[model samples]
Target: MAELKAGVVATLETIRNHFPSHVITTRATATGGAHVIIEDVPLGPPYNQATTWVGFHLSDACPYDDTYPFYVRADLSRIDGAPLRCPPLHSTGQVFPADNSTTDTRDATMVSRRQRDQASFVFESPLSKLIKVLKWMLEQ
Candidate 1:
């Protein structure tokens, strides 16, 4: 099942004709997946404003097992980013935010960016690989 899923993603690259605008890159490239930043991607409805990134994951694990094989992820994340376009100052003619609203937006954006930068999404194998390792060791 995992192998089939991985194959589909790789096949998509071929189907898309290896279009740069059709792929997205990831921070981790252990599986040699394609990645790109795109603006207009078809998502069924024509009104969707979200950016789309479609790619495949290849299992890099050697001597793979079906139960635990190398897998590719057909994942999409919202690339929602708005510039801090605060109002400009009147006296200084500065491209600054005006009034308390501008200050508030700045504060909120800073907090959000900091939180996002500090946060990470990692799934740790919690079922205990040691148990499986022990079972394999005993068999050997």
Candidate 2:
């Protein structure tokens, strides 16, 4: 099997392929952190989501010969500034103030598959257009 770069660049491609309707309005600086603004489209909606400066460290066993999602992370959300809103979990294992972990929801629905002892999140949103792409990928 082939693989991709073990870093943020590959994750960015995953985001683009999964959410093509969303636009990366702003790219991060050379420092590996920046704001990604996603605009809702006609088929999608009118919501602008931003993930500012999400960390992009790589793992030890990344295969650069091919291309794929190299890193594993959780939900991406807009960072707040002293707001009354709750923060989004960067990883599914994180705990929330309501005495529940993000993993609960994930465990309830997502199937688990492991590689090299690292886990990844996977769920097919019926509303996600990525499913169409996935179907096409399987056909080919």
Candidate 3:
């Protein structure tokens, strides 16, 4: 379990480095794997649609194991006043920044950049290329 958690941390760090403009937060899940929050990305009908499209492409490019180290989920309820829980200090659940702690806050710059990048990927890039890149990253 420790090894898996370490791997998850490493993978999250790599993803954070790759997407410097995006905000990445990690919270310990009851299942041992972490819930990675890609903050500032819009959630709802259209965004869910885009994620579904991406997931379809990703699934063909990589295997998804729901019981593995992690899984991607689209939680639209977050936009509708749901509070994000940060674990209490003594609890096994704890939150950490993917980057250095100082930069973890969700700000205008991060939000705008995330929105722009998401839009660009959904609209401008070819799905095949995106799939290839994501597959390559996962295989790394």
Name the weakest run of 10 consecutive residues (lDDT summed) in model 2: 105-114
Report lDDT per candidate.
0.25, 0.28, 0.32
Using lDDT as the measure, what is the rank order of every candidate, best first? 3, 2, 1
How much does each candidate deviate from the true structure in C-alpha RMSD? 19.2, 13.4, 14.7
TM-score of each: 0.22, 0.27, 0.31
TM-score of 1: 0.22
**Descending-TM-score candidate ranking:** 3, 2, 1
Where in model 1 is the C-alpha error above 4 Å? 1-40, 61-140
Each model's number of backbone clashes?
9, 1, 0
Model 2, range 54-100, lDDT digits (tens) per residue?
Answer: 11222223221111111112332223322212312112333211113
Best model number under lDDT: 3
Instruction: Identify the candidate with maximal TM-score.
Output: 3
The candidate, 1 or 2, that scores higher on TM-score is 2
Candidates 2 and 3 compared: the better one by TM-score is 3
